[model samples]
Target: MIRIKRIYEQLGDDDGYRILIDRLWPRGVSKENAHVDLWLKEIAPSTELRKWFGHDPEKWKEFGERYRKELSEEEEKEDLRRIKDLEKEHENVTLLYAGKDEVHTHALVLLEMINKKSS
Candidate 1:
């Protein structure tokens, strides 16, 4: 199974194979504390798109659309495939992100895409 959690959340044994999906490292979170198995920054939305969205609820729909288009690139496809591979190899995979607005984050869009593809 795949799960999404905030990077700042307390680490748990159930958070198997944690992967950090943010383009930028969250401020004040050290590597040791993060306990992340992989930092797949490439899977994150483009900086341009991120800045434009600015976590505004109004732009969420368009943000998802633009982010989906961004993920269609070859490099992003490879990264997404890697995530799928991890899910198969591990009992559970947790995607970690630093965004404050969980509902409007790229990680949510990425999760939807991944789950949609799997289904």
Candidate 2:
């Protein structure tokens, strides 16, 4: 399963392989504090798409679709391929993001996509 978690959340045994999906490094979080196995900047939404969405509720649905499209591209697909390989190699995969609005962030959309592909 793919679980979405915030970078500030404490690391635990349950989080088998923590992967940060944000294109840019999170503020106030040192690399050592992140406790992530991998930082897949390639998997994040394109800069243009991310800026356009801006976390506005009205643009959320469209943002989800667009992000998925961005994910399906050749470059992002390579990242997805790596993630899938890791999922098969690990017990669990934790997707880490820095967004304060966890429920409405790109990580949730990435989790949904991962779940769909896995199922």
- Candidate 1 Cα outliers beyond 4 Å, as residue runs: none
Residue 29's C-alpha lDDT in candidate 2? 95
Q: Residue 118's C-alpha lDDT in candidate 2?
A: 68
In angstroms, the error of model 2 at 62 is: 0.8
Question: What C-alpha lDDT do the candidate models reach, one value each?
Answer: 0.91, 0.87
Q: TM-score for every candidate vs. truth?
A: 0.96, 0.93
Worst 10 residues of 2 by lDDT: 110-119
**Candidate 2 — which residues are off by over 4 angstroms?**
none
Model 2 lDDT tens row, 1-119? 56888998889788988999999999999998789899998789889998999989899999999999988888776788788888889968899999899668999888777777767
lDDT of 1 by residue, 35-111 (tens): 99999998899899999988899999999999999988989888888899999999799999998887788888999
How high is the lDDT of residue 100 in model 2? 94
Report the lDDT of model 1 for residue 25.
94
Model 1, position 79, has a per-residue lDDT of: 87
